[model samples]
Target: MLILWICFLRGARPILFIDGCHLSSPYKGTLLAASTCDANNDLFPIAYAIVSAENNENWIWFLSNLKELTGSISVTLISDRHPSIIAAVEQVYDRDRHAYCYRHVKENFCVETKKLQRGIRGEVKEDAKKLLDAVCYTHFGTEFTKAVEQLRAFSPELANWLETKGDINKWAKSQFPHRRWDLITTNVAESFNSWIRKERTHSICALITEHRDKLANLLYIAKLEMTKWNNEVGPKIDKILMEHVARSEFLKAVRYGDHNVMVRGSNVDVCVNLLRKECTYLEWQMTGIPCPHACAAIKLLHSNIYTYVEECYLKSSQEKIYASSMIPIETHDMPDVNNLTLTDWENNIFLMPPTTTRSLGRLCKKRRESQFQDVHVYKCSRCDQSGHNRSKCRNPNPEKI
Candidate 1:
């Protein structure tokens, strides 16, 4: 799928396709794997760690890989409601820097309720409905909280279970202000699933290899289609670039305090407070953008400063691409997916399964083994059971008995 997406994107229509699947391995049991592609027709296969749905340790192991994958990139991950996926995401992306699939969240809620809400589903049905509608980040927290509160009235155990899982308030704030409703769901991958179903039903090797070739051909075609369009866009893009260069030069020349205005660290003595008042205002307002003075400070403070300007001063870089005409273009507010063409079906492709030295959980098990530790055997104090420890003992006191 990543290969196919890469091909489709090269046609001047940059697009990425993400999907998860259950597959059997020759040595290991069934594993769930995810895959991504970029606009350059570059395929990044199994860019993430594979995890087992049944293992709690998989959640932790996946998160370590997630941290490595997401290092500072503005990334949003969409996945189904596997507990491991959710837990790993929360552990790695607590800042809400990533967007989630509302579709996945909705389906998860419904599926969990149907299977586990046997006793309380009736009472919390309305709450669940509200949560489903509140898929966008804007109202996600409010609706989710209200619904959970209602659920608490019906099933304290479930509500408490959710709370104990993580900091609910933190997660709520991070998910608010959703980018789009469709973003919340799992349909992006579904498109690929349908294609995969139609294209291949043979041996696993044939499935992986054939899909890859199909995607490569599709990408080549997309590039051919994009050549003329790119030619036209190139000159216009160059003109825009020239104008931007001039504007940036002007901003750089504008001075603050004793030094040229910069966007990096500097001592107060070396810098003048060109916009100290503005910096104060922004700080007071809790707005992250740098004030004019902060920009000035950057010039005097560091030998190289512009590198940090976008990050430190601009709360939203989207605000920087000025011009009424450019606004719509900048937004790239594409229409609904239904309006999008899945385009080339025969061209769609799948990726090769990733090679792993060990399953994800083996990291911990390996660490434990390396430590030469004894097997963690448990004994219940109350019941003298071998399977449970004292903390989990459910029987009355052994002494009393």
Candidate 2:
């Protein structure tokens, strides 16, 4: 909590990826966490709590605790469309900044399309997926509408499901109101969950202390890495800038005014205002990096492209974000109760864990992995062919042809 307060206040963006994962043995509870990205585009965990279950009440409790630190400032919280999470965010924070993770929404879209399939084959569901993918990636309203119309062409019911179940403004990149950058999922938070699986098998104290140690080490590594950065911007931002610079080489920039430049080439006709750091495509504003159009304009004026980037993507911000580190909590000493008086021992009440019944199934200690998600294709050893094992292989017969 101390590190979160100090580092986040100084640097990291006001965007959180909140998620919950089941704690394994020793503490059978749900670990709810709030994490955000740093200037280097890496996972930076803020806070976590252990709850008996993932429900509306627990989620509210978690977010409420988080709200105290965040204060009244609006934050862009990206997560799945969980009913509990949706309800919790609406109550804890304003719903205007709540954005849906595109991946989760896409998974839901796949679900609805599968429902629409209804054992049908050769229905061109791939085309439907492409349309939805375009909608998710597009930033322009016209492009989004065109993509949605294409999706509607595939099936009106499927399109209706997307509109009704998934909010276009929340999940669509072109329509999202906040500065979420390129992150569209809770992947970092989920990575945190998976990273601590072995630690979850230990006692609660050990699990927490281990988390601190890992974060402390990570920060130290980041500090060392920061000294090596050659560019003014963070590594990720530098890569993006160079890529934009290369792409802008094809376009021709014509000065319209003191700050405005009209860029045209390869089907690109857009306006770039170097002074305002804006582009007609809106990519520069949304991503905090100069787009190809803006880069072309900057090149025309012989100005530094890095000057157009937002301050949040710079090395200073990255350093401030990782400046604070957690001190390891040593637990070598344990207070012995043998010297305590009998009266003192009798005065204190120690409560045991609550009684619980094991559910009637094989206990799951990790995430629910779909069996069909990673099916292996068998190859025949005898014939040196694919798709069938040696036992099941039908060897080619020369006489049969």
Assess candidate 1 and give its lDDT: 0.41
Residue-pair clashes per prediction, in order, are 20, 1
lDDT of candidates 1 onward, in order: 0.41, 0.81
Model 2 scores worst on lDDT over the 10 consecutive residues at: 348-357
lDDT, candidate 1, at 313: 23
TM-score of each: 0.37, 0.90
lDDT, residue 149, candidate 1: 72
Best by lDDT: 2
> Any runs in candidate 2 off by more than 4 Å, and if so which?
120-123, 330-333, 336-366, 370-378, 388-401
RMSD of candidates 1 onward, in order:
21.4, 3.2
How much does candidate 2 score in TM-score?
A: 0.90
